[model samples]
Target: MAAASIFAVIIFVAMFLLIVLDKIERHIVTLGCGALTLIVVFGICMRSGKAILGTLAVGDFFKKDFWYQVTESESKGINWATIIFIAGMMIMVEGMAKAGFFRWLCMKIAYMVKCRTIPIFITFMIMSAVLSMFIDSITVIMFLAAVTIELAQLLKFNPVPMILSEIFCANLGGSATMCGDPPNIIVGTSLGFSFFDFLTNTGLIAGICLIVSVVFFYFVFRKEIVTENGAEVDMSKFPNPSEAITNKKDFITSSIIFGMAVILLVSHSATHLTVASIGLFIAVITLISAGKDALSLLKKVDYKTVLFFIGLFIVVGGLEETGILEYIAQFIESISHGNVMLMIAIILWISALASAFVDNIPFAATMVPVIQSLASTSGVDISTLAWALSIGTDIGGSATPIGASANVVGTSVAAKNGYPIGWGKYCAKLAPATIIVLAISTAYIFVRYL
Candidate 1:
């Protein structure tokens, strides 16, 4: 490897370690690493007088030449499309949240279940899965956790089992759609896979995983979810679900816009429109519909996360420029000996296991380029590898607490409600179930795709 490539690997590894440690805010670490990537690589190129951003000066920052030189490829750009799409989704979710859509939905589900312990447990898991298909899993789990805790307290059952089940299902279900999980968005957008592509390829497998997860978790938590014999389960204690809706007009408006955006995503191939346009359009429509409260709706967008993607993209772009991704792809090819099945299996299991312990978003971002390089090196089917990676990262995060954003949020919500679940307990209960689902997904991919 060259000196520049080695330095890029060092910076990339440092960024990964910092994120896992989480001592500093992740956005800060990624942004800093991204800046360092450009600076360090530019310095290396300057010393050698090369053209890896070596010729462009400060004045070219705003020129088309800069983007042409820097972001000339899908694997080597800031991916503003992903940023805009995510920001749009976030604002849409916030609009629905402000209108109390999630709360009403939760309360409605609770009412329909009518205090049956098993029904409540299964229904919430299904809800978690379904809701996460469109909205963020973390956001889905956030409101779901609050409602779940209240039901558990009222019913005299342990919330840990129910909460864990919900988190696991959310991760699995989030894999079914392009906007469901951040990694899916990153992969789908980067690879030019449309929404329907995700729905067809991963959605079917994810649905199977959801079923596997639901049954496995029910048996795992069967004893804990039982209510006391003397506990009074009264339906009168719960209020009307419709009462939770704060603004009827906003709820209706947001619902329509959210539906329209999803429809556009699903038809992206036929519409000939980029996902970015659809996302921004939805966001604007949502804000405009909010009337005088448009400014407040604007605040709903998570700028930190948007910025985080920017930094991560730049950092990954540096790796691509330094040719480290190509090196890794070559290494994988040598290891697999040109066997496509072996390559798929290796990527799937390794991705799943690695993602179980760390945040899958950055790992997925880093792997996108390597996977692209692998496609060029080995001539393997791109859809197969993309699905393998999508399932691995999407479902893998459910194995441990820190693996995904949804798990972290769900854990905090449970702990605050006095139903704390330790890391050992969480892994002991969920790791096996997660592995089972991963195994099933592996076989499906190997036979169907490979």
Candidate 2:
């Protein structure tokens, strides 16, 4: 027990420092931490005369050993559904970009506002947030950030506020649906919570947070958005809307396929059509429409992110497999005195606060086993607690620069537009809003569910 606790703490500490340093790629950092964790925990157990190998399979421990070992380990641990969904979504995204769907959509929105910057800014926030509910937050952040930087150049306003709003709303919006955020996906699959179950349970809260988010943006950025920077931005100089809509048929097809994919993804718990299967089906049909490009789209997908997830899973899995999570769960349970509501609050608060500092994916992944143990020992129904964890960690991701992938991408987008958003300033803008929402969410879960 002592050995497991010490090793888990070291792994967590090392992972946090590496991420904050910004020098190491997150996947490498996580993978290294995972490997270190397995060695220390198991090495200690083996030295202590415990038959650790008897408990852990050769296939699970050795990643490069056998093909079936690697395959089975991944099949059991990795979220293939997410990987497939991301791959399929990338194809649709590529088609959209190639078809100029994003440019067309932006131009239409810009044209509708008649080049009014404030309204255009608000529209960007709403659209980014809405899209994040179905698509990945970081992808939406990248597109929105690129477009907003362009808009900043077009509108002659600082891109900082617009980028910040987009990032903020993206995090908040991703919390709306199970398929929206990585942490939410982890919660959904591990807890056996349906996609609809996530949306339904947290739907109202997320909606309320969305409304609050809009208001939060208005106050936070009102001065910046209304400021006259240099001169009027001539939208007429930007690319014409007509030129942006080159492939109307392809655009329509991609849109339809994406829409159907969203429906299928959300209906997964009922239909049992995993996101991976749906993605494969979509990828095949897309290939049939667009030729070999659709099949090749898999190469463009973010395998690194998937690898990061895999490593993080193994890292946390080692902790659980080594009994660290059980120790922490027992400690939490003792402190809570078997008070279910107190345990829920602690889980929500700890997960949220921890998420703000480190990557929420690993944070949430690590918490899964802890929460499960707490649930079993304390006699708590983890269904609502899982939702609480999802909401807090997903939204808490907005509180800091290193919190989520979307935050990092959004800030980078801001930098590209010559409007640098430093860690200090970005956190200052987001901390208050995140704290308020987290507090409300924490109270909401305890009061209603408890």
Clashing pairs in 1: none
The TM-scores, one per candidate, come to 0.92, 0.85
- Which 10-residue window in model 1 sums to the lowest lDDT? 65-74
The global C-alpha lDDT for each of the candidates, from Candidate 1 onward, is 0.83, 0.74
What digit string (tens of lDDT, one per residue) describes model 1 on residues 217-297? 888898888888846578888678899899998888877887898788787767666667777788888888888888998
After TM-score superposition, what is the CA distance of residue 3 in candidate 1 from its true location, in Å? 2.8
Q: lDDT of model 2 at residue 61?
A: 28
- Against the true structure, candidate 2 reaches a TM-score of 0.85
Q: What's model 1's lDDT at 419?
A: 80
Model 2 C-alpha lDDT per residue in residues 103-192, reported as the tens digit of each score? 677677877787677887788888877788887887788877887777666667777888888888888888888778888877765666
RMSD of 1: 3.7
How close to the true structure is residue 94 of candidate 1, measured as C-alpha lDDT?
Answer: 90
**Prediction 2 global C-alpha lDDT:** 0.74
RMSD of 2: 5.1
Best by TM-score: 1
Which stretches in model 2 have alpha-carbon errors above 4 Å?
1-17, 32-76, 227-238
